[model samples]
Target chain A: MYAAIDIGGTKIAAGLVDSGGELLARHEHPTPAEEPVTAVEALLGRLMADPRWERVRAVGIGSAGPIDAAKGTISPVNIPAWRDFPLVARVAEATDRPVTLAGDGVAMAAGEHWRGAARGRENALCMVVSTGVGGGLILGGRLRPGPSGNAGHIGHMCVELDGPPCPCGSRGCLEVVASGTAIAARVGSTSAIEVAEAARAGDAAALASFDLSAKALAAAIAGTAALVDIETAVIGGGVSKAGDLLFGPLREHLKEYARLSFTRDVTVQTAALGGDAGLIGAAALVGHAEV
Target chain B: MYAAIDIGGTKIAAGLVDSGGELLARHEHPTPAEEPVTAVEALLGRLMADPRWERVRAVGIGSAGPIDAAKGTISPVNIPAWRDFPLVARVAEATDRPVTLAGDGVAMAAGEHWRGAARGRENALCMVVSTGVGGGLILGGRLRPGPSGNAGHIGHMCVELDGPPCPCGSRGCLEVVASGTAIAARVGSTSAIEVAEAARAGDAAALASFDLSAKALAAAIAGTAALVDIETAVIGGGVSKAGDLLFGPLREHLKEYARLSFTRDVTVQTAALGGDAGLIGAAALVGHAEV
Candidate 1:
């Protein structure tokens, strides 16, 4: 058995997983962003005290980056307090178990590849289009974590060289165009759900906003297909919840812009694991890690 | 021994390669884009007449899209006469050897991964920034040909959503901003060399053009690093000959925009193989195909 932790800016989730990638027990808590170390320690302590924790042999963590997977450290952009935090060592010290780490998007991709929409697919991209656009890759049947565990930061890839400037200091990144934050920002709202509802109600402004976002996403997908030659893209996150309102337009735009025959064949679909992907993928690390 | 053929719009290069991926002998001729089949046949005849052909066991071909690698058919966008042409069968008939085919860019990546600049690197992207931008990928130590073998068409990725219309029917693709064609077009010239020379001579317009191209390319590289998590990018082709004029500004832009630590770690370097990359990469196909 293994323990998987999905650490986000707002919430921290923990799960007990079996060798077959099954979830035996799960729990969640609001993240204490102000006290980063204490928050993580408390979360781990609470989870470790649970009856399910007795069976856990290892721990896997997925966090927002920039991360040093090799060193098990995290320096999340949103979590300013987590500058070079020793995530893996702290978790291991608290739990007395082996630990592994990866970016949140990478963990999501692992979950999808292991048992979700991208199963059996050797080359695929798993993306989370939420508050921010994050990505993870399964290329040539292996997980690509990059040199610093920052692989799959697709949101930051410049989609429009002259478009809006991203918080990362780049212009026209996919995140700035297609992320839930971008969507909300476009409609002058605070949540993606509002934008989705507005678009569904035939709000021209909302619809236009989504159309632009979808086009940007499709363009990025087409480009990504060309770059990595992946066959499928499994999309997850809040923005993906818009369903056809997002995917239909995204596909239409992809067909228009996908110039290469091979790239045109790429399929973009919703993720199958939903929110559980991060935890499941983190657990999957115990079984598959080199990728 | 293996026979490798690089079928370009303007040239046909054939090489005899040993098991160690060395070129034993090489031949080159101008390609008859107007009569691709005849040109290919003529090249095959020349290759077969060589004594090295007697020892060659298989033939590998790399051509421009859209090719059906599984069916060994070619329909290059630039070679109007190659629509649905049975290139593999023709080559097989000519050489009396088994034949395999892939996109020229894919083959280039395979070649680089097998014995060139990308050797020992598990995940790398090899790009040719010549007349038009092209790319090939080695992901997780495997060559990615994608579904239709037209993967690695990085030049077409939209870097500017409203920058310029590409021949591929897309607006603001990376190729429109950073490719040799795009650079030359921006300068009202016909070749990247002229643009490079102008930039070298402190032509303000040319320097600005290169800077813009570098910025676009840097954004794309940061994006690619975000998606695939590769550590190194080995760049080749005529445009790369500009050396520091291109790379200096690219690195500067990347550092400024690549806020993610992992993405910031990505190294962009010149390809080590130089002009021989295509032929050597073609020869590297033998080992790649077997794998």
Candidate 2:
């Protein structure tokens, strides 16, 4: 068994992952968001202290960006206390096991590539379109974490050249257009969940927002296909749960944008694994390395 | 020594290349454009009959696309006489040599990556922005040709969300905005060469056209950086000869589009090799494989 940890802004999760992509024992606790760096490490320590960790051969961590896997540190935007924090070293000290780290997006892609929607695909782009969109890549049959371990940060890719400015410093970033937050803010619905409900109730404005978001996503996906030559894109996260409401328009727009012969046939599929994608993918970082 | 062939719409070039990226013997023939497929093959046969061919251990060919490199066939848009023509087999039959094939863009990139501007860089993009914009990629220190061997077809990547339509059935394709053909058409110039001269002479419309083209190229480059995590882009061909007139605006616009921490400050450089980029790159396809 391998121990997997998924670190995010709101929560810290730990699991005992088996070879079959199963989480034998899983635990989670709310993150003390306003606390200092030690508070988060303390939560990780408590989780590792669980008796199941003794059976683990190695530890894998999937943290939010911007992670430097080579340096074994992370500077996640959501977590303020940790700036270039040595999460890998801390985890190593806590677990006394070899620890592997990758950005959360890359970990999620690894999980999908190993046992989820991207399974059996040699080249794919797996994305999570939630509060802030993020992604990971599987190219030439392996996860490409790039030099900085941020190979698939697709959220920040600018699709609309003259589109609205994004907080990421680019104009018309995919996250600013297609993310759940973007979808909710399009018409001030307060939440994407509410927007989905409004769409279900035949609100033309709500439906239009989803359509607009899908169009931006299609442009980015198409551009990615043109550059990197991918035939499959796997999308997950809260906004994706809207199902056909979002997917219906996404596929339609994809046809318009992915017009090249090699790109036109690219298949877009929903991510099979749910919330645990981050945790399972973290485990896959080690699993895949061993192979 | 290796034998290299570069086939395009207007010319067919042949060269004998040494291990040090030198072109020992070189010759070219204007393409008999209005002739049959046999005429093109005969030209290739005549070139291989050169006394220099005796020392060549392998052969490489870079052809216009859309080429099915795996099938050794080509269906170039400009070469209507040959639709999926068996150029690879015919070349092999003509010279009895082990042949390797790649798109012209990939060949140019491989050439530059092996010994030119992209040298010493693990991840880079090499592009040719002549009549049309074409490109190739080096990812994790290897050429990525994708499943179709057309992995870096950057010309068709749309940068403008609501921009102009392109001949490739896509809206705002990079080629439609940044190619030499686009530049000439944008300013009603007889040729891009003339447009460049006019810009140097302080023609307002010509200057604006170049700026527009630079903006589009920058958008595509920025988008590519965001997707693939590349920090360097090497540009060549007709339009690139404009130097700072193009590079200055491109770098400026890139900063606007490639705004993320990882993507910002992407370095743009000019191609080192001149007209022979395709030939040397074709040889590199074999040279790199041997290493």
Candidate 3:
């Protein structure tokens, strides 16, 4: 058995996972947002006291970025309380087992590649298009976290060279143009779910907004295919749940952008694992090298 | 000893290279633009007759793409006579040695990574910005030709989603806005060299052309960094000879586009091997797995 922890801006999740990737017992807590590392230590304490902890051989952590896997620390954007927090060391000490850390993006990709949409694929890209766009690469059938464990940052890639300014200090980044925030901003809505509801009710503004987001996503996906020759792209997260509304236009625009022979055959699939991807992927880190 | 062949649109180069990467004997032939495979056969016959060929253990061929490295065939866009021509089999038959094939872009990057500007860098992008932009990647201290031997075709990646139509069927591709052909078109010149001369002579049109090209190159490089976390980019080819006319603007624009912590430190350098990169890279293929 493996112990997994998923640290996010909104919540902290803990689970014990079997070798087959099944989460046997799960626990969750709303993130304090301003709490220090003690909060995480307390959560680990609860998990270690569980009887399943006796069977756990290793611990895997999936944290929000920007994480320093080399330094075993994280400085997530939304969590203001933790700047370069030593999560890996603290967790290892609490659990009394080997610890591995990966960015949430890398963890999601690892999960998808291991047992979900990208299964059996040698080269794939798994993306999460929720509040923000994030992704990771599966190259040669292994996770490629790169030097800083930030290899597959597809969200920040510039698709429009002289387009609108992004919060990341660049112009025309994919996240700025395609994330749920961007989709909401396009139609004067408070959230993308509202936009999706409007689009389903035949609202023109909402429909056009989804179209534009799909176009931007197609460009980024096709660009990734050209750069790395990925044969499959597995898209998950809040936006992906919209189903054909997003996938229909994404497939249409992909035909226009992915014109090269090698890039032309790329397949886009809905992520099969849904919300459990983070915990499953975090546990997967125990079997792979630290990202 | 290695027998290296670099097959380009205008010329075919053959050389005997030692293990140290030195070109011991060199020969060149003007490509018979309309001729069939016999021309390459005749050239190979001359190369085989040389006494130095007796010591050659393997032969490497780098050809203008689109090449099917897996199938050992080539169908160069410029050389219409060879449509999926079986170059590898023919070369192996003539030389009686094991042979390998790679795209010209992959060869140049391999050459640069092996001994030129990108040498010692584990993750780098080596680019040639001549008539068209072409490139290859070095990841984890080795060349990553991807699944199709075209992993680092940076030129074809879209940077400006709505900019301009590219010959490759995509809009706002780096090649359309940044290649020597693009520079020449921007300046109403016959070639990029003429634009370089005009820029050196204080011509506004020529200078603006180079600046725009540099901006596009910067966006692509920064985008590449975001996607793959490449640390170094080595620029070569005809327009790269413009020196600071191109590099100055590229560095400045890179600062603006490469804003993420992981991407910000990317360094740009001039390719050290110049024109000989193709042959040397082709020869280096004897040591790597098929792209």
Candidate 4:
């Protein structure tokens, strides 16, 4: 088994995952998001206290970006307290085991490719559309983390040349139009859940917001299919929880942009691992070098 | 030595290539583009009539797409007489040598990656922006031709969500906005050459046309960098012949779009092998399976 750590904005989750990619045991703790580095480290210490800790052969961490996996550091957007934090060295010191690091997007892709929606597919893209949008690539049957560990940032890719200015300093990023945050803002809601609820209640404004987000996501997916030849896309996170409300139009809009013979054949499916995909993917990074 | 065939809209060019990617001897025949398939085959026979043919061990053909490299067929847009032409099997039969096939764009990219401006860059995009824009990818130190050999069709990848409807049935493709054909059409010229000369003479309309094209190209380049992590882009073809007139604005506009750290570092360079890149890349396709 490997000890896996999944760091996100809301919380820090850890688990022991077996070779078959099943979580053997798990623990979770609220992130001391604004506290010093030691608080998070202490949370990790608490996570490893599970009886299965001794069975872990390696430590794998999947953190939000912008992360420098090569430098074993992360400066996730929401985790202001961990600026370029030396998480890998700290984890290695505590576990006395080899540690692997990758962006949360990459970890989600690896997890889906290993045992979830992308299983058996050699080339795929896995994405999360929550508070922020993130993505990862599976190419030629392997997880492509890229040099800076940001290969599948489908959200940041600009589909609209002059559509809208993005916080990444670019204009018309997919994240600006398709992310859960974008959906919430467009629908005049504080959360994606509220938008989903409004849409379920058949509110016209809410429906339009979901459709617009779906269209942007579809365009990004089609563009990715054209560029990299992905055969499938596994989508997850808060926005995907909207289910068919987001997916039906996403499939329809994909046809509008995916005109080429190759791109037209791509398939879309919801991620199967739910919230624990990051944990499982982090574990795979420990020994599955390609992932 | 290998036999290399570069099939394009205007002509059929064949040459003998050495192991080091050097062209030993060559022959060019204006495409009997409107004639029957037999006329083109005759041109290939004449091309191989060079005494250097005896040294050729394999044959490679790079044709304008949409090509089915797997089925060994070409359906070049201008060469309508050769729809789904069995060029590979016919070449093998005539030369008694193994034959390989790739799209013209893939061939150009492979050629550049092997011996030109992209020689040392493991992750690069090589493009041709003449009558139409086309591109190919070099990923992880080798050419990635994708499933149907159209992985790097950067020209077709949408950059502007609602810019314009392209003939390829998509909207705002890089090709429609940035190709030499587009430049010529925008400047009310029959050819890109006239547009270039007009721009060199400080014609305001011609200069703006080039700038628009450059911006489109830059956006496509930046988007590709964001999606695929390309380190460099080597551009060729007639529009590229305008030199700084095209590249100057391309670099400038790239800065406006490539705001992400990984994409900002990407460099753009002119193609070194000029027109011969396709022939050499076709030859590489024979033995380098990745290409």
**Just chain B of model 1: what TM-score?**
0.95
Model 1 agreement with the true structure over B117-198: per-residue lDDT tens digits: 8999887888988888888877768787766676677888888766688888877888888988878888798887898899
lDDT score for candidate 2 against the true structure? 0.85
Model 1 agreement with the true structure over A134-175: per-residue lDDT tens digits = 888887687777656667778887877678888877677889
Per-residue CA lDDT of model 3 for B1-291, tens digit only, reads: 888899998989888878888877777888887774666777677778888878999998888877878888888878989998889998888888999888888889888877789888999999999999988898878888888877788888888878789877878889999999999998788999999999999999999999999999998899888788899999999889999999999999999999887899999999999878888888887766533
Q: What share of the true interface contacts does candidate 1 keep?
A: 0.85
- On DockQ, who's better, 3 or 4? 3
* Stretch of 10 with least lDDT, candidate 4 chain A: A35-44
Report the lDDT tens digits of candidate 2 across residue range A180-219.
9999998888999999999999999999999988888888
Best candidate, lDDT: 3
Under CAPRI classification, how is model 2 graded?
A: medium
Model 4 bad stretches (over 4 Å): A34-36, A47-51, B34-36
Rank the models by DockQ, top first: 3, 2, 1, 4
TM-scores, all candidates, are 0.93, 0.95, 0.97, 0.94
* Model 1, C-alpha of B110: deviation from truth (Å): 3.1
Docking class of 4: medium
Give candidate 1's root-mean-square deviation (CA, Å). 2.4
Ranking by lDDT: 3, 2, 4, 1
lDDT of 4 by residue, B53-114 (tens): 77888888888887776688877767778787787788788778888788888889888887
Between prediction 1 and prediction 4, which has the larger TM-score?
4
iRMS (Å) per candidate? 1.9, 1.4, 0.9, 1.3
Worst 10 residues of 3 chain B by lDDT: B282-291
- For residues B261-285, what per-residue lDDT tens digits would candidate 2 score against the true structure? 6778689999999988989998998
Q: Between candidates 1 and 3, which one is better according to lDDT?
A: 3
